[model samples]
Target: MKIPPHRYPSPLGRCQPEIMDVETTKRDGWQEQHILVVSGDDSRLDFVEREFIRRLGNRLYGGKRHE
Candidate 1:
């Protein structure tokens, strides 16, 4: 599911992609947080970001805590 930099679309309609690195740091040891980095066109970035968040949220909080 990882898209290569060269295959990413550009801001102007062409492929102007780049590299993206993501890292996560925990704070307070109670709440969960995430960090995302993207180096590509902003066109489909929002949708992709939303999907990532949605999927992560579902995985983290969708099920019962004790289950």
Candidate 2:
């Protein structure tokens, strides 16, 4: 017998549909790396930026800035 999946209510609540519309632009060529386009409230954008910097650090800029 197969078991049914259980769903838990999220403490954060549901996401805003209007605020969740995201668009992305694609680029060609090896030098033109793929980009993530985030469109939303400032807080959301800020959060993504902070996370990228935290995880990528100087590598975000190809690591040449630190050198």
Where in model 1 is the C-alpha error above 4 Å?
1-45, 63-67
Scored by lDDT, model 2 comes in at 0.51
Question: Which one wins on lDDT?
Answer: 1
Model 2 scores a TM of 0.19
What is the Cα-based TM-score of model 1? 0.27
* Tens digit of per-residue lDDT, candidate 2, span 1-67: 9998998988667663445323322223223775543323336457777667655744654544443
C-alpha lDDT score of every prediction, in listed order: 0.52, 0.51
Backbone collisions counted per model: 1, 0
**TM-scores across all candidates?**
0.27, 0.19
